[model samples]
Target: MKRSFENPLIGDKVYFTKYATEPGSPASIIDVELKPGGGNGLHYHKTFAEHFECLEGELSIQVGKEILRLLPGETATAPAGSLHRFFNASAQPNRFRVTIDPGHPGFENTLKIAYGLASDGHVNKAGMPKKLWHMGTIILLSDTNLPGFFSLIQRPLAWMARRAMADGRFKRELEPYTR
Candidate 1:
């Protein structure tokens, strides 16, 4: 099964072609379209690595302080625990295939929540959640680790996230996104 999600605020789209739950699929794969000058900020994951293969246009993957520039068919990887991000500096949209090694359904769900938040104007200019609790919930559910000083608040946010999950806030907020 394939599902497409869009972040209207950033003009980004992710088409989920394969997920862990799918038969014979070992990883979560997405065909992503990124708007010019748009992409995510630096973040790292502890559980999974990400592979990016440029399918069209130019793609730049930044791992640590090094940037790997790619043309069509080129690929780069950010291993687990590496701080990284991807961006499109061109004037047009760029398409790339991203595979999350070892697959993470929670990560996929976080994408859904993000897009839903953007559609509802609940995200900031950079497409991050405007609400601290919401951001914390996403951080917990998605296994996303923010860098540097931002990491300090992770614990408090996680605490709020646990409460949200137990109080049904998680399900209520995710319900709109899943459909």
Candidate 2:
């Protein structure tokens, strides 16, 4: 297995073991270890489904209006366009595997850029970039969207971010990951 990437939102490490673009693979697999009180807030993907398999410890997953607490060897699925989120509500660390169907465009690079930005102290307390341009750039690059009302502005926001990036204002932040 390859080394993991540090994702502040999920945990200290997230291993991208398999990519969706790999020949014969239909999805991307990610192994994550979530520390106590760490987890992703409500979010959803519009184009790809997501499945989670608990590997160790406990994981709390919210799919739509339902909350599923998964134990070791248990699993759950959230279809595309479903509102979902995951977190470790226990005191102990939790480990799980996530599979994203059809893969997300620039998924790996987006993770790297987010983590790298956090490492550089460029993100806010929620692990999101402090600058709107940076945030928009990530959203556009990864094809990730916030649920509900926030989704309404994603298109225009992405357009502005893309314009900034092209003009060199946000290019520096994406340098390491893009190269």
Candidate 3:
């Protein structure tokens, strides 16, 4: 099955073409179309590796301290625990395919939640949650970490977020994705 979502927060169109739910399959296959100057913040995954292959336009990827400009057919991998981010630094759109290792069900759910929230206008202009509690829930669910100074408070915020979720405040909002 093919699922697609447009995330205004990150200025990207994402398509989920395949999901790895069986043994020995790729975690997930995603096609992304990034608008010019669009990208996500520097973050790291604790348990999964991400691989990116540029399908069209210029894809600028930062892995650790190295910046790579990938063209069509070029690829890069960000191992687990490595700080990385990707963007379209050029004047046009950047299309790319991303593969995640050790398919994570929570990751897919997080994407659906984010996109759904954005569609409902619950996120800011930058495509981030408008509420602090929502942000925390996302962090906990996605298992993504923000590097640099934000790292200091990530844990505490996530803790509070988890508490809020457990209290059932997010139950209604999370229903679509969770179920």
lDDT by residue for model 3 (1-179), tens = 33888876666788886766745585877899999999888999998999999999999999999999999999999999999999889999989999988777777767877887898899888787887877887888778999879998888878878887788878866656544
lDDT of 1 by residue, 129-148 (tens): 88877888788877899998
Q: Model 1: residues >4 Å from true position, as ranges? A: none
> How far off is model 3, as Cα RMSD?
1.8
Clashes of each: 0, 0, 1
lDDT of 2 by residue, 1-179 (tens): 23467865445677887877667677888898889888876877778888999999999999988999999999999998888999998999999999988787476667777787887788888887887877788878766778778888888889878888789876665756543
Output the number of the TM-score-best candidate. Answer: 1
Q: Lowest summed-lDDT stretch of 10 residues in model 2?
A: 1-10
* Clashes by residue pair, model 3: 9-127
Predictions in order: lDDT: 0.88, 0.81, 0.85
After superposing candidate 2, which stretches have Cα over 4 Å from the reference?
A: 1-3, 8-11, 168-171
Best by lDDT: 1
Clashing residue pairs in candidate 1 are none
